[model samples]
Target: MPLYLLRISSEQTSFRIPSLLSIAQVFDFPIRFVSSDLFRGVLVVELQREDDVEKILERDILVLSATELFAEGASYDELHTELRNNMALFDPYIHTTFRITMESCNHRIPETRQRETINTFRYTGLQGEVSMKAPQVEFVIVEDYEWEVANTPEARYARDGNFVRVYFGRRIGIGRARSLILSHSVKTRTYYGNTSMDAQMGFLMAGQALPAPGKIMYDPFVGTGSMLYAVAHWGAYVFGSDIDGRQIRGKMKGKNTRPGVYRSAAQYGVEDRFIDCLTYDVTRGPIRRGGWVDAIVTDPPYGVRAGAKRLGRKEGKKPLREDPYLMDDGEYSHQKPDYLPPSRPYELANLTLDLILLARWLLVPKGRLVFFLPTVNEDYDEIDIPIVEGMKELKFGAGSVQDFGKWGRRLITMEKTALDDGLPPTFEDHDELELTKASGKLPGHYGFNKRYAAGFPPRKDGNRSESATPPNTTLEKREEGME
Candidate 1:
């Protein structure tokens, strides 16, 4: 039997197992699929027999990491029970002792070598601790490799003796684009209206969730087409559109554009012919009707960046200004002014509502709309769009900043329903909608949340103490050492 690895998000282990089981049933695989945590929140499922691994791709398949698996539609208790049941069925052998072998190359180490060394070390150390008490012994070894040696005199003159080490630890999602380009030598650029990984993760998670071949995926807010590259790598018919004419023309024309997107595409074996890049505004234009879309996954702007200008105001102008009000007396009262078109947040909210409503018009009823919705003051209750019913929200434990240290964002999945007869009334007024006040101070009222949920602590304040344990800390530390 061929070995098949099923990767899922960290906290989503509960849903990942069931999804694996479902895949097993769909593929008609016999017996049980062995599952193990590759790292914290990352579950790897090895099919009991991989005889028909290719067949699973024929259906709409998703390989979720443990973190994103159960965040939606399931409770922790339910997932725990399922996990225990699955473990009982598998009769897995619990490995308590961890052997950590640190091997180093004598020559100047490549980036890949350094990464492998640190990852292996962390994995052996942390995973061992999880399975048993403490990883019994850590072994370190150093070896000289060909890449480390300089053959020419000039090369020898510039050579700095360095050892490349290898190890393993918890693996987290580095946005779909980063993960896809991890093994490649090409440069990568992410196109996003909201420059945050939260937007990228939704696309990444959706890419992991959806089946390849015959499935069509699109991102309406493909500011730079970052998400487009991720889904396209999985052999799906990827389509991307942005309201910005310049971005589309730049990408299409290939003039003075960053070579990363094209280079990465070539490296991934996806040529320009495979991707469909277009320019269109979801709020104003139609999304080429008559074709069925399997998934509409995107991160609409939070009215912070690109969407701010579209909020009907000139750039750099405040939506609300404070004006002095003179009464009969000499005393002046400060009056809060209103927006010319309205604040970008309100305008973007309306645009988002329009997109959701329009997505329903375009999507095959029951199609999934997965997106990263910005929270106002950390409050979600303020969203009062009747068009978006059956809303499922997943709080990514860690914010995007924990991984990239930028913005904090959340994941929301809403399914298009056919029974729209009894929907609630839509609120046209922005002021009428109830806004929820976040308990803690958020970075920006409208910027992308750099802190993703995967690395978030159970308590908001707990994150402060556990700040050093970020998923990419090892990588960052190693990079610094190399520099």
Candidate 2:
């Protein structure tokens, strides 16, 4: 195994380690630990080969770069001594055109100091031509400055002794898949709603699902096909089924009449992998039970932003109204092909439970199920995730919260261990987030707690900020033909 250094982005610190580990877990790559405190902007690991490092870089959204470690020490004097002690490490790049790239965390190293540092490492006895642009081999020196220091400080205050640790390595690869974050950004997309998944978060969610070439993926609560595009870019043939048809169909129609999801697929150059997004409620979903789909990734709508809805009545014993849904000839009006059905609020806990069962029935053995669940951050450090037979939830953390106010959502990933051989077990619903563990009275997640009622403040127009799932004017206009 070759020892490697990974320069991780400081953003989403909790997700960085898990993101890399998920890629390794998916690809069966062995990542042995070589450092103790690994998550602080720098990671040192022992990988099988350069190929394994590249495999991680292809899908990991948090890791910035991967390098082959040569030598490292706390100080520049100690670094040079370590380099000379193992001078054979520099033998391969001695006669080749090479360049040394200096990088520092917590403080910006001036170009003058950068040149001085590069010159200091010249004692490696490398009599090679210096090529900055197209180097045959590139070595990187990273300085891990004191984290307590003020971020974005003046370079004059950037002292050499301020650095806690330093590393010297040969640059092997960078996180090229990070480009997908910007390429599929919401701002750059053709059809995205207010609640559509963020590009970075979309990639993060998709990575957890372990999407790969020839993998069959699906998103049941696919809004505007955001999750679909993210998986499709990774060579997975992704299909999205939404309860609302309007999301699949373009809201805008005039000259270029392509639909939203499909149009975005073409624009993203992923049309080949973009399996059509059909309209259907997940509760009455048409998908057959089988070990077919490789992965299932989606952001199930919470109460706010995107109101979770399913086909049926708003509230009542019977699903239909008192008025007979039939024609003069006694034919069911809903049987008329163009008829649209009414929808009701699909609660959080129930939706989470249904998704687990659906994944158990639909996914192949070891196939992943990745989705989001909102929880009250103020209540506890961790929410009790859904526990079920044959559906194993992988532990990442309590929840990656980033200024989510009082409550926030976390991405939950589980794998279908085996086909359902027994009946679904139920438990007492003491907590709102506890899903399948339900037996007695079920008030549901958001209905009772009302944690999100004060989430998004009301707008001047009286309607809350959640305008994503608005009143359907088309449905309101169809009073005589309403479902």
Candidate 3:
């Protein structure tokens, strides 16, 4: 098995490994790892075939570049010796037009020093044109150095900041970095919301949920259709539903109308892939059939940024009499007679339970249900995540976390394994479920405000400060409208 170098992005490091593994499984390509330095962002793996490089690249959104490793060493002396001994590998490219690209972790080398280093390879064999332009072959030199040690005068004297390991490879291919620039970006889209999922995360979630093309992807809480955009881009026909009609149908303010998710699909040239988007709440169970949708990719509201609400009763609300004459649509009226349904605060515990139940009822066999579950970093329990009766847990991990505070979201992907024989599993002991209904007197309820305030601070009118500490008010104040 030949070794290949996979260079992945530093951002969202936790997701990159599992995503690659899942993608390889979906494509039936085995990802046999030879070695990996997670901190240095390097992975050496063995692929079944050379063409599997392109297959991995097509699915992986985090991978930056891939290469066929020629030589690797722990020190400069070892690298020099290895290159000298491995002259046969470079024999074919020696006389051909080539360029050397250098990358380093925790170390920066001057161009003069790099050229001086490249000069060592020059004396190895036949002379070749050093084409800085388009080259017949491109070789890469990557160095990984200790990040904790600074490049001080004393450190430099002792070679303390020297590279820990060095890798030499010929560039074979790249990942979806370029494609994500246009197709996956929300900045390029016409519509977005406060809780709209970002392009990279959205696409990654879509990839995890819908592993194949021509699949029917559904997002019950599709705000701004961000996830739907990603799913559609991956060749899946997407349909979604949102409780708030304002999100689905942006707004019709006078003569100018701001179109929502449906029209936004045209920007990516995947308009046909977007089947429909309904203004219906997920808790109401709009999906009547079972085993229809191939995948469910959603970013549910976490009691902030977006409020979790469902149609319910309101106290002291009087029923208004409806006049048939006034309700006539063809007649010219001062305003459109839109029927507004009353909504109440939906319990977080019930909301998640509904999502799990919906996934169980709607997802086909082997179809994945990928969704995000927000939690406090300190209280993050994998067991707290809801378990559907018949769904098989595929992958679950903290996809992202706040740098300054104790807030994070886990990406839970489960596949439907069998039909529910009786009923869904109950989550009585789950800390999140208990905290949702309990008062501040409870143990876990104390950090509810702090956890919610981690990624998003309490809003002062419109502005939000970066501080993670909640305002002087109690957790009840922070939970005012979040429910």
Candidate 4:
């Protein structure tokens, strides 16, 4: 099987890789590895077989790639025509589709100084135009045989005929940029989390799970409704709940008022009536009218500052005496003043508990739950839930605490145990060391040995202890110390 590399935006790289792994797991394909550097703006996925490519390029899947490149002093139009002509020579079945687009670079090379040793030609075609600003797939052409110093060293370059370097691949799409723009657009006061979800991750998570249109899909902690929005756009009837009424109401209203908000759904030929949003506290009680959901896809609060905030003690201390939204006095501070008490302490554990409880109550028999959890706290125990029968963990994001605090998020997939099965396996008196040996750090915690091991060794410098010579010698030293 011929392999194809599926590229995604780097902004979405963390989630994207896991999403790809999840997709690979679902399709039973062996995912080699995920590479973010193969392309400048997108994460690259190398599929083991060409057949697996369709899983990602399905109608609901939003394809993203770069589209064009300019030779400093070359004729843009002539280069475009030449590239299109070259593409026409290749058999469609053998070659992947290439599109030409244009973009103006902030850097300029004057024509008078243009190098004649290498002929410069521009490439363009299905990839969108460059001037449009953000195109997913870019194209470049080289008509020179000599390779002058590569103009854009950061961009991938290849030598062709007289023009030795042609470069093109996948880039981030404008749809996401537009999403951000409209989210902050002045027409609405809707609050959209400025952070970008790994686009590749979103696509993989969505692509792997078979679309169940008309069947209800749930997101317990649907922050900004990103996951639900993606699923709904794919043809599922999405139902989402969050403790924050403002987010639920705000997103619902935004979707209803904003034109073309569901354009992806339209593009996928899905009906417009496939989404519903509401507010419910997962920890407090059963989700209203809760039952079996076809799938539960969500990016839950990852327990960092970026996670959802809880009312402070001062804010939740006093019950709402009246409607805060309607209060004539402008003393209200919280977004939903009427709902919040005077003061309360914000805790990430409490929020996690709420979401887990909600998942237990609402997930359909054998339903799938995809979530992103933070693993920064080594002391916290692995989440143990009775209903969850199996889980697949994926390590993602940069390892730094600050980076993880900002963008680090790991993915975990759980499936509800079937009724036919007896009680799920239970363990007693298990320690961290035993668990680490069993699961080898569970994907994301790659540095488990360093973090968890007791007195393993000094990591910074390879200095041996004066008394500790070797493992056997150390045992004798311990005995001598006992004497």
Candidate 5:
């Protein structure tokens, strides 16, 4: 095994490690981390091959660069001693065109002092040409000031340890995977909405789906094709369905000022892989069950700016028309060109449970279900995650939280370990695409939406009261019985 130092971007520190681990699992590459700490700015890992490290860097947006670790130390004196002792590590690059550079994590190394430090490292005798412009290889010296730094004295947790850590390695790849973010940024996309998925999160979700050539990925709550576009960019054929046709098609009707899901895919040159975008209510859609999709990735509406909806009319509401009438185009009154289907509120709690159940029947063996779960910071728990009998083979892979003051949302990756023979059949398989199959009564819990609006109330001992939490629903509880 070869050791490598992975420099991670400080942005979205919580999202950094899980994404890397997901990439490794996708490629079936075995990696041994020196330490499995979640927020380590610099990671030291033992990889089977250097080429595998490059492959990971090419897909990971969090990893800034990959380097072959020659030595590390707690102090400059110890660092030089270790580097000198392992002179053989630098032997190959000795005759090759190379340049030496110094990098800092929480501290800055002045250029004059960096040159002075590079001069002191002349002990490892070499007669290589120093080409800063087009060096065949680059050797980097990293000085880590740890979590505490001179900038944020208020956040200092403890007294600074001596030197913290230092690493010496040869750089291999830089900014390759990270460049994908700039390519899909919402600011540059041709078609986007107020609730479009963020570029970075979309890339992370797509990666979690383990997309590859010949694989098919789907998004049930696709909006403006953000998630699918990213998946298509990674070589997967993507299709999606949304309750609102305006999201798939253009909200505004015009040719020159075009705004549709297809335009966004074309913006990134992935229109070919962006197979289709249809309109359907996920709860009652006409999708036949049985492990057909390779992966399911989506950012379901959380009822903040964009609320969730299902095909159904509001309770106690009277129909505008008493009897159906044929129109001039020989169509029913409700089937007019301007007719809009009626819908009812679909809360996050039940929608999330149904999504998990849907994944159990829709994803292939070992396929992954990646989505976001928004909850109050004080009310969230692993037990709160929805699970059913069919999801016995569904295992939680990773969860990364994006905290916002009193509340936070977690990006959840649930992988289907294997097909569940005892799993129940789909409910909507034999039913028509109508809300008559569902009850009009709404659940007690409205999920993050109601809580966010009322302002999150802190829970005692990090546990939710039974009356306050949403009751779990299963496939058997619905009217469509499983046989």
Candidate 6:
């Protein structure tokens, strides 16, 4: 087995591990973690082949770079001894045009010190041009130390006494994270809504949901198709449906200044991967046959920035008997009638339940469903997660939550574990979705929506709580609607 070192971007510290694990699962790649500290932003893993690194770089947006590790040790003397003992193994790279770059985490080394360290290996039969401009082979020497050492008087956490670990490797490849970020950037995007997801997060969702190429991914609440852009970029043909036609077709002004999701797709040269997009209320959207889509990825509205709405009629409303105008052909006719259907406030619980049920019916066995579920940190209950008979929760630990000020949205990833038997879940199995309670508490009060509106409650000292949780108090009564 060959060992490799992975350098991850420090941003999105929580999402890195799950993304790595999910990508590994997708490729069915057998990997063992050598350095497993998720927060350290570096990973050393054992893989069977070197080519698999390219496969991971293709889909993972959080990884910065990867290297084929050569030698590692807790001390410089040990590492030098290992390299000297294994001179035959180092002959291939040492004889080629190569450059060595130094990297450190939680510690900084001066250029003088770095050069001094490199001098220790320079005399060991190395016969390559030190090409600083363009090297045929690139080598990286990483020195990692704990932040505690940086603040202490005993600072130089080098390999002698205080350093945590040291790595020496041949740089193999860099991740496509920068290009992906620029590709779907909202700043350059032609059309987007207020609640449009960030490009980085959308790319992560695609990685978790559609992992492989040539899969069919569908987004039910595809407002502006921001998420679908990521899915299509991953080589999956994408389809999207939303309740608002205006969003699907960006509103036209005097000229064709603004185009919709398709225009954005065309801009990215990914129109071939985009199947189609439509405007339809997800609650009554057309049903797909069993095993229709490979994955379902979406960012459903939580009524914070965008209202959560679904199509339905008011109580006691009846269908019209006849149309107001008729053509000579005896057909109800209108040249350009702008008729819109009525919609009601969709309950957060019910909306989530519907999404799960839809996935249950449409997803192929082992197909994934990745979506964001907004939750106030205080009321977030892992047990309250929606239960579907055929689906299994995949990633639900720390990597899931992307936090804001006291409010955060959790990314829920589920896989269809079994075939749908054309049956509905029993009452006791899904009573959580129902808004009824003897206390007459509205559905919104118990979940993310209510917590968002109330914000973080004030402490006993009358200061707002900065922690993820609010003060331990019951929520006050409010209107029966989402935030």
Instruction: Give a tens-digit lDDT track for model 6, residues 286-308.
Output: 65456778999998887788767
Q: How big is the positional error of residue 16 in model 6, measured in Å on the Cα after superposition?
A: 1.5
Q: Could you tell me the C-alpha RMSD of candidate 5 in Å? A: 6.2
Clashing pairs in model 2? 427-438
Model 1 C-alpha RMSD vs. true structure (Å) is 17.3
Model 6 clash tally, residue pairs: 0
On residues 1-483, what C-alpha lDDT tens digit does candidate 3 reach at each position? 778988877777767766777777667878776874553578888887878888777778888889898888997678878878887888788789888888776666667768777766665664678788898988988877665565575654465327778888899887855478566577767787788888888877877885466889898888789888878877889888887878888866785364577667887778898888887756665555677888999987767676677776554665433543344657534244365566766655456656766677778877888887765555444444446556655643333332335556667677777754234333222354343334222222123434475654432223212222221111211111101
- Candidate number that wins on lDDT, 1 or 3: 3
TM-score against native, each model: 0.46, 0.84, 0.80, 0.47, 0.86, 0.84
Q: State each candidate's clash count.
A: 53, 1, 0, 52, 0, 0
lDDT of 2: 0.73
lDDT by residue for model 1 (1-483), tens = 322333333433323333343345434575334433233222334444334433333221234311112111123234335434434321222344443332333344445554564453231223334322344433322232234447775674465323221122221222223343244322333222234344334333454325355667777776555555556655667777765545443443345454334444555566552456665445444544622666677767654454422422344865444565575756554332211223233344444555565555555555656666555333323222223443222222221222222333444444555433223223243331122113232122222322232332233421111112211111011111101
Candidate 2 has a TM-score of: 0.84
lDDT for 148 in candidate 1 is 44
Worst 10 residues of 5 by lDDT: 474-483
Write one digit per residue (lDDT tens) for candidate 4, span 1-483: 222334344343334444555456555777554433432333335555545555544432333432222222244445445546556423331334444332222222333323421133222223323333433333432222222445563432332122322333233232332242243232342234543244444544554344455667777666555565556655678766666665544444444653222333343344364465555544442444444666677766543334454433343355645554444565554454355433233333334334443444455666666665554343322332112222222234331121343233445455544433232122111243234335433222223233333322323322222332211001111111101
lDDT of 5 at 88: 92
Worst 10 residues of 4 by lDDT: 473-482
Overall lDDT per candidate, in order of appearance: 0.40, 0.73, 0.68, 0.41, 0.73, 0.72
Which parts of model 5 are misplaced by more than 4 Å?
148-162, 251-259, 319-331, 390-398, 420-446, 458-483
Indicate the TM-score of model 5.
Answer: 0.86
Model 1 misplaced stretches (Cα beyond 4 Å): 1-48, 51-203, 208-211, 251-267, 272-275, 288-291, 303-346, 376-407, 419-483
